[model samples]
Target: MKPKVIGKCIIEKEEFPDGRIRIKRTTEGITAFELYWHLEQAQEEISKQLMGLLKPDIIKRR
Candidate 1:
């Protein structure tokens, strides 16, 4: 664990073979923050694409 996030960490997953992500709630477990970040980024991109029909804000923001 990084020194900065030693106490604040979690175990999360994304893009499973079953087409689902899973988050673990075990104690003293490893955390996949990288996966979480990518998943969130993907969701945002997808939302922007889906909302593009109603919103043109992303074009300017991006």
Candidate 2:
């Protein structure tokens, strides 16, 4: 399948007081990364083979 851009997205950059920088991409209120994750999972489901597994503790590490 070919990939397509379905909608508009927003990119944001932030600087912390400690001189740290963070960049994020979002669409509608959902972060683009998370949105892509859900889309990828859905695609895997349709293929009947979800190999892109993440550990249950992955969030804690992040």
Candidate 3:
């Protein structure tokens, strides 16, 4: 089963356009990092990171 999303942390680069990293937290206490370079990238990365939080092994690999 997939975990529920609980929170997020986003970091934006002041000097670079579309440069950002986002970290999402799940109800299961898992977190995943995302790298973004554009609007699509930001959306895609958040989705990818949230999916990563669903796997039990993802935390161990960090």
> Candidate 1 vs. truth: CA RMSD?
15.2
Candidate number that wins on lDDT, 1 or 3: 1
Q: For candidate 3, what is the lDDT? A: 0.56
Which one is best on TM-score? 1
Worst 10 residues of 1 by lDDT: 1-10
Give the TM-scores of the predictions, in the order they appear.
0.37, 0.34, 0.28
Clashes of 1: 0
lDDT of each: 0.66, 0.72, 0.56
Give the residue spans of candidate 1 off by over 4 A: 1-31, 54-62
TM-score of 3: 0.28
The residue pairs in collision within model 1 are: none
Q: Which lDDT value does model 2 have at 52? A: 35
- Which candidate wins on lDDT? 2
Per-residue alpha-carbon lDDT of candidate 3 for residues 4-44, written as tens digits (9 for 90 to 100): 43356454434445676555533332323212235568789
lDDT of 1 by residue, 1-62 (tens): 45222234556665688788777753443346755777899999999978876567757677
TM-score of 1: 0.37
